[model samples]
Target chain A: MSVTPALDARREFESLLEPVATVAYRVAYNFTRNAEDAMDLVQDSTVAAFRSFDTFQKGSNFRAWFLRILTNRFYKSRKRGRVETTPIDEAEDVFLYRQAARAGLLGNDDDPARLVLDRFDVEAVEAALDRLPDEFRDAAVMYFLNDFSYDQIADVLGVPVGTVRSRLHRGRKILQRALWDVAKQRGLVHGDGPEGAGA
Target chain B: MGTARRAPVPKDMSCAEVFARVQEYLDRELNPDEVEAVKAHLDYCPPCARGFVFEESVFETVRLKLAASACPEDLMARLRECLEACDES
Candidate 1:
């Protein structure tokens, strides 16, 4: 029945930590592109977080504070990765939809967003992200995956919101191109609507 | 086609402008007038409309896919152990 303050605090910390761990791991994996490495990063950062936990203001943003540590470790240990700045024209896949519409493959009945969901899996999506440079990938993961606001992302990335916006914008274009190809290759382009895509 | 009478894109928002700011529009980063301009453009521009849909899907799918990946049990155990060690220190 002898519970120390440290043990009680540990219990409190773990309670808050458990829910966000999955997301923290996922974000770490995105950075390292290796589960083992991601685990290491998370383990190291969690230890760091615990040491500094006393300084953490109650009711402040734990997720953001912890993520900043994780990202800092990643930057320290991670090798340089490529980040693409695709030309606006090359990044867009509107031609595919336009072609689908013209061929009657996609008509009023079809929802392109729904189609995208059905076509791409987690691996395909991750591969596309891998193609992005490290900074853009981090921003995209934070904004899209973690649902961080642009300002939160900027805070984590140590940049202005404008930078986060540009990175996300560019990241989306690359993803669109990659995802469209997956959809086509999966034979989802059957143009099965009342209008014929091939016709 | 009743839509044939309409212009290809919004008179106010050019294709270039829409293309440049499409992410901002989707992110709700645009102002009221700017949002209206993008909306108007989307109505008339079929390609941009298609692009917009796919972009939306990509955004949502990334969130869903990544969020679905849970931390491995071993890592969680390790983290707990690490924190326990911190308590002892």
Candidate 2:
């Protein structure tokens, strides 16, 4: 069944906005790591998406298309000095590693004690996330936490699907290695036990 | 004393290869053969297993933290107001 041109376009646009808005906000939050910045980015992206509604092709993945707009807008405004940049590097890594390690060491991970300490280590993970490079952290959080698929991520970032896969693959590896190192140092995992220095 | 030559995990079995299947593993998207391979590798290789565990934990932690940091009532209200303003313009 063919849809009436104007009516179909409007309906399509509205439908797209509902689901995409939440995803956009989540992605923005991951990118900015601040409520105010995320809110602004979402708002700006929404308006821009509405303005360019005609350019969006029907039956295409709207979520990715809209996200690409949001990401571009974010970087443009960021370049214009609207958003603050958090430089992530060795210094940030060292700080986060130390913090998580100390936190892990102090938290009781023993069987019975773990029941009480599970909540505390979430903060440690957050600190580790804060240490990641902005793009890696942003993409990782969006894909893993927000549940956007690889194709959607590619569309959002205006890159090829392979690039998204590589970014996520690399981003996850770095995060996993960092967290494991911290966990090992903190004694969260018994490396020297039957697991034997790796587990 | 000669250095012990560790058995190779197949150069094809780099951390990247193991990690690529991780999401699939978590989502139960892998078929039997792939699942078996990943599981077998994890069983013998503590480092890879630890890495997987770490990845899982990070995902869990981020999910929890994001849930906890949901936009407060006032913040949501403010965001709605801003959205409405954008609509009017």
Candidate 3:
């Protein structure tokens, strides 16, 4: 049948994408934060992937390959939506930092990350992540969600590795502050009447 | 603030140096000695320790949350149909 090659192509595409579709969709969803846009993004990327399947090297990681396409689509659409801008939370940042310090949370030997892990739940994590600016959040999300290495994230985002590092660093600080707030609200930790009024 | 506490960082490691490398250290990209330096600094430096803990926990949180998530079935179906169109075209 004339359709055999096309069917074979479709089959090949399906086989490659099926396993990672959920992840691909999730990545797109992370980018768009809207299911409909995410769906469109993934669908469009899928079509693009199929169209260019011939270029994909066999035995290469399909997740990275397809996701590179998916992310490119997202980046293209968002070029107009949000430009790279600096974070404007200096006052709030100092407040959060001092709060964590004042709460006797900073100097302790206890795992600060554990407070978030054991006390807060997934929703809180998502909320905290939602508050990050797009530049930092995308790298952070991709790093955490897909277990992408710094190098892979850099490659996918098409930026320098240093940029990925900075985003993760900044993103982690924002999330740490968010998690500290969560702990305080739950009374998981409380103020210890300040840490000698120091930094 | 950090300038005062960092006076005795062994091997000239400053608080800024230790904290700055937290992400790379956690990522295991640091050299063995660098990792030891961070661990050493974390022992006495609560701020960096706490920050490290928070960052570590962030990794754990993501792993936990992603463990339970799945793609909606209809989206998967929709994706397949989208590919089917490629077959026709």
Top model by DockQ, which number? 3
CAPRI band of model 1? acceptable
Task: Give candidate 2 regions above 4 Å deviation.
Answer: A1-23, A52-68, A79-117, A121-123, A180-199, B1-24, B27-36, B39-58, B70-72
Q: RMSDs, each prediction?
A: 7.2, 8.7, 6.0
- Listed models, DockQ each: 0.32, 0.16, 0.33
TM-score for every candidate vs. truth? 0.78, 0.56, 0.74
Candidate 3 wrong stretches, greater than 4 Å: A1-3, A79-115, A182-199, B1-16, B31-33, B39-54, B66-70
Q: Judging by lDDT, tell me the better candidate of 2 and 3.
A: 3
Instruction: Rank the models by DockQ, top first.
Output: 3, 1, 2
lDDT of 2 by residue, A1-199 (tens): 8867655554556667775666677667767767778888877777687668879897898877877788778777762212342442222211222233434432433231232125347545555565566667767776755567777667766777667666665565566445544555576653322212232
Candidate 2 chain A: worst-modelled 10 consecutive residues by lDDT: A88-97
lDDT per residue (tens digit) for residues B9-89 in model 1: 344977777866766777887777777888888898977877677556546666787677656877678899888776667
Best by TM-score: 1
Docking class of 2: incorrect
Give the range of the ten consecutive residues with the poorest summed lDDT in model 3 chain B: B1-10
Interface RMSD of each: 9.7, 10.0, 6.8
In candidate 2, the residue pairs with backbone N, CA or C atoms under 3 Å apart (3 or more residues apart, or in different chains) clash, namely A191-A197
